[model samples]
Target: MEITRSRDFTAERAWGAKDIANMNGITTRLHWTDQPYRWHVNDGEEVFVVLDGQVEMRYRSPEGERSQLLEVGDIFFASVGTEHIACPIGEARVLVVEKEGSV
Candidate 1:
């Protein structure tokens, strides 16, 4: 078993992630980032959980472009083909679950 503290996490690069689990080709990662990610669509569904800090989640849909503020414990569900981007308000920790190599 392993234990990790979200608040104590840090990385050398923007959006660096630690591999937590890989089961049945689905991967779970713990990410630390202070920058915005590029907009892209996931090939499969995604479960994005904020472990610490806040973020502005922007997405493009058939209706139009929209954004939401996500705080700690917030979960953003990105369905397949949902174009989205994550802009962290500051240094934030996140847990992402999705099919391996979805990016």
Candidate 2:
């Protein structure tokens, strides 16, 4: 079996990730970031979990643009074609689950 301590993980670049698992066409990853990710819509659904620090999640919907603050232990779900971005408050670790090869 494999084990990981999310708090101890780090990366040299923003949004750097360590692969955790892959099943079927899905991937689970641990990501470390200190910068913001670009706004884009995933081809499939996405599950985002904040493992450490804080993140401001921004998204655009039919109404307009909106944002939410995600703290440790918080989760954010994005359905297919949902435009969104994640901006770290400082240094943060995030767990991401999505389709394999998705950005």
**Model 2, runs deviating above 4 Å:** none
- Report the number of the highest-TM-score candidate: 2
Roughly what TM-score does model 1 have, to 2 decimal places? 0.97
In lDDT terms, how accurate is model 2? 0.98
Error of 1 at 15 (Å): 0.6
Q: At residue 70, what lDDT does model 2 achieve?
A: 100
Q: Which stretches of candidate 1 lie over 4 Å from their true place?
A: none
Residue 86 error, candidate 1, Å: 0.1
Estimated TM-score for each candidate = 0.97, 0.98
What's the true lDDT of residue 52 in model 2?
98
Candidate 1 lDDT for residue 19: 90
